[model samples]
Target: MAKNILIVCTSWDKLGDTKEPTGCWAEEVIAPYYIWKKHGYNVTIASVKGGEVPMDEASLNPPYLTKEVEDFLLDDEAMKGLMDSVPLSDVKGDDYDAVFLPGGHGTCWDFPDNAELIALLSHFVDYNKVISAVCHGPMGLVNVKGTDGQPLVAGKKVTCFSDAEEVAVAKENVVPFMLETRLKELGALYECGPEKWAPFALRDCNLVTGQNPASSARVADLVVDALTWK
Candidate 1:
């Protein structure tokens, strides 16, 4: 049977605070898409909202941009998927085997406060389905609560965009709370990469996480594995 996945990406940015326009990393979303699509998985693109996805122009240019992203942009099918993404309110865990959230500061603003996102994640976690996130995408987990009324991430090992990386880009001073600190407060035992852009990931049962943009593809791969596990 073909595996199915729900891919979530960020579409929010706040100008100077971002230093650069930031959206879901193309590599993180594209690489994973290629791998899973090749292996015959049905992938769905969704956002906090259900309209046009705002891409980070900076991440789509130069060394960061690759053949895959260019192809994805040119692929009308995929482009349509991005442009008319489903709203989180419509995504149900039973409809997909896995759920993946690619990262960006945009997610920090959008993912955390979305009630629909919280419900979707709670459904995935409750059913033992794979739920994964990369970089700031893990911010989506902030409000997800299990049926027990406990935070779904509580006591789980996870990773996301590090405070160190945010500081290097000069947003640490202004951003309210740090991701690492917030996760800690939720009782999540967070782990991260040794350096800013390094790839780091965690798999605590059904919860999967990645440290930063570099960890995106790997994070998706692990999620696929977790979902396809027998």
Candidate 2:
């Protein structure tokens, strides 16, 4: 049977108190979606509130926008699927082989404290199912606890959008909390690429994580490989 994959994205469209627009990073979700599709996985899109999920306008501009993102924009079917993502409340971990979270600054505002999302992640962990996230997506895992009542990331090798990268983007102060710091505080053995914006990902048992938007495709590949190997 084809493995079913759930892709969760942030529904928040605002960037902190700056009132600037932000949503799911286009490349972060698009690159991985196509990669998994190419590997013959069934992909489904979901979000906190669902319906008309927004793409960060910044990620759609030059330098950040890549062929994969551009292709997703031009693909009507894919575009529709993204715009019509299901509500997170309607999703179940048992129905999917894996769940992936794609990030944007918006995720920092919503992903961290969502009780339902935390429960879903815990479900995947309990079952030893693959759980993956990139950039600020890992914010969702910060509050997830394992069956033993410990932070799921406690002592687990993981990575996410780093403090230096956030500082470079001038949003270090804008986001609700520093993702890198919070992950470390949660006892994640955090790691990052040598330089900011470089592609880096880590896999620890059933959990896979990427450091930034540049690592999205590689993270998806890692998830597919892990599922296949199992």
- Candidate 2 residue lDDT tens string, 1-230: 89999999999999976778999999888898998888888999999998988889989999898988888889998998788999999998889999999999889888988998998998998898999999999989989998789999998999999999999999987888899999889898999999999999999988999999999988998998899888
True-structure RMSD for candidate 1: 2.1
lDDT of 2: 0.91
Best by lDDT: 2
Clashing pairs in 2: none
- The TM-score of predicted model 2 comes to 0.98
Q: What is the lDDT of residue 10 in candidate 1?
A: 69
- The runs of at least 3 residues in candidate 2 whose Cα sits more than 4 Å from the true structure, single-residue gaps closed, are none
